[model samples]
Target: MLHVSDIHAYYGQSHVLQGVSLDVGKGEVVSLLGRNGSGKTTTLLTIMGYLSPAPGAITWDGQQIGGLPPYRISRMGLGFVPQERGIFPSLTVLENLTVAARRGLRGEWTLDRVLDLFPRLRERAANRGSQLSGGEQQMLSIGRALLLNPSLLILDEPSEGLAPLIVQEIIAILHEVRAGGLPILIVEQNIRAAFAVASRHYILSKGRVCFTGTTDELRDNEAALHQHLGV
Candidate 1:
């Protein structure tokens, strides 16, 4: 349901995403993978309108949205969970999720639904964001995004800097979300986590797509895994 074609983006005068292209189809989970500086997050930032892409096009469900503002894109049913897990440090866990909640046409994602998905959030409902662990904060971030009831979810580094068990939990939650019919475009440094949930994977190098294939194909190609992903 999302398509990005040869998008180029820059930070100041330095080009960060050059000719990057990929897609996330309906009900499908797609992973964007690469080593650091390979433009994975840059591609996402560009797609979400934090950075504008020049000389390329981005269409969601067939409408061009390359240069729209972040809020506009978000209101168009695109939910973003940034790499930093952008939660309000002073706000309570319940407040963090409730503030971003929006009732979609179907209202499939609700605060109770989200809390059910991450039960720990319900337990910490009264705790401030800064009082939570890294894993809890990550859960809060994902929950807040879900409360938007987006058509497509784009998550950057969802499994970053967490315990192994927490990573596994997050991966399981992603699978559950995929099963619930939301298409996802995920950028992950954790190869195992990406493989666990995404059907198709794209590896980037120097802001370009270096490889695109199914999970099975990626797993079988040790060379691509080593050369592009350092796996």
Candidate 2:
């Protein structure tokens, strides 16, 4: 339910997302894969309006949101979980989710539902964020996002810095999330996790979309993966 067309963004004088375009249909999961400097994160930031796109368009459900403020975009049912996992270190797990709790179109996600999606969070409901492990923190991040009941979820590096088992758990959780029919736009370095939940993939190189296809197409085209993602 989101479309980005030829968007160009910049940080100071340095161009970041150059003519990058992609789309996420309703209930679809798409992953953006790229090397460290490929502007994947920048594209997300631009869509969320943290960085305005000067030369392109970003539309959600048909309305143009190219330069809207982040809060305004979020209010329109777009949720973003950045790579930093912006959980409040001092707040209890329940408190964190409660803080971002809001009603959306379906109102299908509640604190209890999110806690069910992450049972470990239920056990640590009263614990502070700093007391949790890396995996718990990641779960908390995604849980907090779900509390918003966003129509489209944008996640940056959800599988970064976690152990294999934890990554698998996160992937399973994402699979369940996908089953719930929420469209997702994710930027993940973990190829396995990205492929597990994403039906489609977009590979960026030097700030532009160099490749776009389904997971099976990506698997068959190993040369493109090696060229754009160095995988």
Candidate with best TM-score:
1
User: Which lDDT values do the candidates have, in the order given?
Assistant: 0.92, 0.91
How many clashes does the backbone of model 1 have?
A: 1
Please give, for residues 1-231, the per-residue lDDT of candidate 2 as tens digits.
799999998888898877999999999999999989899889999999999888899999999999999988988999889899999999999988888884333488888899999999999999999999999999999998888889999999999999999999999998898998889999987888889989999998999999999999999998997888778
TM agreement with the true structure for every prediction: 0.97, 0.97
Candidate 2 residue pairs in backbone clash: none
Cα distance off (Å), candidate 2, residue 136: 0.8
RMSD, one per candidate, in order: 1.2, 1.3
Q: What lDDT tens digits, residue by residue, belong to model 1 across residues 1-231?
A: 898999999888898888988988889999999999889888989999998889899999899999999999988999999999999999999989888884332478988999999999999999999999999999999998889889999999999999999999999999899998999999998999999989999999888898999999999999999999898
**Minimal lDDT window, size 10, model 1:** 98-107
Local lDDT at 95 for model 1: 88
Q: List ranges where model 1 is wrong by over 4 Å.
A: 102-106
